[model samples]
Target: MQPLDAMSVFEKVSVADIPARSARRSKTTPLREAISALLPEEAFYVPYFDQETGEGFKPSTVAQVVGRMSKDSADYRYSVRSEASKNGCYIICNPKPSNG
Candidate 1:
């Protein structure tokens, strides 16, 4: 897995299976149902703006890329984006800065 500054996972999730377990949601739980979770808090926001115009993106108008480590030993997706969100993929990302 690649080194990432942070990780993120869906705000909501479930773990019921087979015979069916009590459908309960616990905020304090450490996301056990998920085989692994990505905590995207580490992603940096790279604000893209027109060079000539100082004006920049709106609340939801942002795009970006991120390199995050895999939460589990198995293969997994590195990042996610939110559509429908005016924030365009609700979350914007950027790479961590390198030491000079």
Candidate 2:
């Protein structure tokens, strides 16, 4: 008796025979997801923005990033921006900072 090759057996399998796994939508909102993804921990602040001056600043770790992001106004459009540095983060202001 001849043994069947694994590759040949695999090729014979029909796509319909395989069970499909359903992808469930995430319960967290996009805002939360982005925030969490950008700031995975709480060790340090991400320096998202200056609470008083409303200027963006860069922080090193994910925690710093999240901490900084947490200080931002939850309802503000600027909070949606996520980047590694202050230059990349969003700053809601008129006549944006000259250095930025």
Candidate 3:
């Protein structure tokens, strides 16, 4: 698969997509609340880990929120995969493709 441009993903994600509750909140809104409100259904939520140590990295906070939310909502979708690469581990979010 081709590499995804992280900035492109961020550019595409609109604040309008976030729920009204989150959008109306002050900047001091909690991280978990912001992330949970922003994420759309069926988004590809990938969480990275150290290939050697098998420990979560910086993006783990978002992963933890998504993991917890997944237990309650069937709309969330995510996967775990192991691959060898020179680059360090990192997580990402991408919009899922439509069937049509």
Best by TM-score: 3
Per-residue CA lDDT of model 1 for 1-100, tens digit only, reads 7456556554654555336678777531322222134343433232334457654343222322222233332344344354443323333222333446
Candidate 2 lDDT trough over 10 residues, lowest sum? 37-46
The sequence of per-residue lDDT tens digits that candidate 2 reaches over residues 1-100 is 5565633443568889988988766422333445544422222123444678765443333334334555563432223234555444432311212343
* Clash pairs detected, candidate 3: none
Off by over 4 Å in 3: 1-29, 39-59, 78-100
User: Which pairs clash inside model 1?
Assistant: 7-38, 7-39, 7-40, 8-38, 8-39, 8-40, 60-86, 60-87, 82-89
Instruction: Put down candidate 3 lDDT per residue, 1-100, tens digits, no spaces.
Output: 5566643444556788966764375422354454445454323333345578665433444445546654555554433233335322222233445456
lDDT of 1 at 58: 34
Regions of candidate 1 where Cα sits further than 4 Å from its true position: 1-41, 53-76, 80-100
Candidate number of the best lDDT:
3
Q: How many angstroms is residue 46 displaced in model 3 relative to the true structure, after the best TM-score fit? A: 13
Local accuracy by lDDT, each model: 0.36, 0.41, 0.44
Q: Regarding TM-score, does 2 or 3 come out ahead?
A: 3
**Clashes (candidate 2):** 4
lDDT score of model 3?
0.44
- In model 2, which runs have C-alpha deviations exceeding 4 angstroms? 1-11, 24-100
Displacement of residue 47 (Cα, Å) in model 3 is 13
